[model samples]
Target: MKKILLSFFLLTFFQNVVAQTNLYENPNFDELAKTHKIIAIVPFKTQVQLRPKQMKDMSAEQLNRVEKSEGESIQTAMYSWFLKRKKRGDLQNLEIQDPRTTTAMLKKQTIDYNNIMDFTPQELAKILEVDAVISGEFETNKPMSEGASVALGVLFGFFGSTNSATINMSVHNATDGILLWNYNKKVSGSIGSNTEDLINVLMRKSSRRLAYTKNSKDKD
Candidate 1:
């Protein structure tokens, strides 16, 4: 009985550690976030690392298209997550800029996925007319939105074990481009196989630490 109890405790501890996010919050995040009424979520910079056989079958253009699509899909999923939270009154007094408007403004500034990294967060905030911006990068071994493979993984609970993804997200204050918060996480298995599921998992863990959420300022 003692051995079984010890084993269960260890399993619970391991799960807690694996589920936690690597989060960084600026010392002045509360002060900075107080002025942040509106924010924009941008397309994540995405890189898809293909196996040799897959690489050989795809052209350079096709690879770029896949990366771009994945980036936009993540951005959209993030927006949906925030929208749902806002509707639930968890994100009080905060407004998220529509992604369509954000994209149009970026295009008006001649910024595309390839060149967006050239601009600083403050520059993007000015262009988008938001108080802050949410941006990130995603690296993955496979296309996350591949419905068939992901669905199969959901059903069988093993196919996603072969896939891996790393996400690093940050919030920057528009005034000075100082990073207010950052979250870095690595995800695998069935939960990381699709954009919606991935963002849902990530944001659920991150929302407690996010500056804009209700009562979040008091959390570590």
Candidate 2:
């Protein structure tokens, strides 16, 4: 019984791991990243699909609110993950703009989150005064809350949870409005998971392939 249960657990974990796929990557990612000094992480676009029963019970307005809030949470998570990695010297020459500052500047410019995708990457990069911009979109099967996310790995022993997400991340050059790189992946998260945990896992895999990181040259 013990062996059977352990095998099931390992299978689930590995299944999730294998689901992450790279959809796109730029040929000149390294050169482009080196040329751009600072990068700003924009708020992610989040979409949640509630279960049939939950959808029947929850109002659309409530779902919209959760979606909008989760966007900001994910943006902060991305920045924080990169910042911490940089601080620990795990990332070299990769400077991430503070998410607080990025949001504040966007607010001051009267840019609404819902309408953010309408804006060109060049315009956003110029407004943020960053040499490069990082943007992403996330789709999840449930309304993800920071607390619930953190609780998964923390309380549930790093196994068995209900969250599944697909994330698409991109980088654009400020000066020329060219997309330098992009990465997309599908992930299944655990019960005690949060935005930080999600982004941390994604970034750990994706960043290794990104340009400007210490190990970029060594990867090829």
Q: Give the winner by TM-score.
A: 1
How does candidate 2 fare on TM-score?
A: 0.80
lDDT by residue (tens digit), candidate 1, 1-220: 9999989865754354344358899989977777779999999999888777666876787777778888988889899888877887767888999999999999999998888999999999999999999999998786776642443234334533445678899999998999999999976654544688678767765777787873643211
lDDT of 2 by residue, 154-214 (tens): 4333433666888898888899888888889887645225777677666666676777563
C-alpha RMSD by candidate, in order: 5.9, 5.5
In candidate 1 the C-alpha lDDT for residue 189 amounts to 50
Tell me the TM-score of each prediction against the true structure: 0.81, 0.80
lDDT of 2 at 145: 60
Which stretches in model 2 have alpha-carbon errors above 4 Å? 1-18, 147-160, 189-192, 214-220
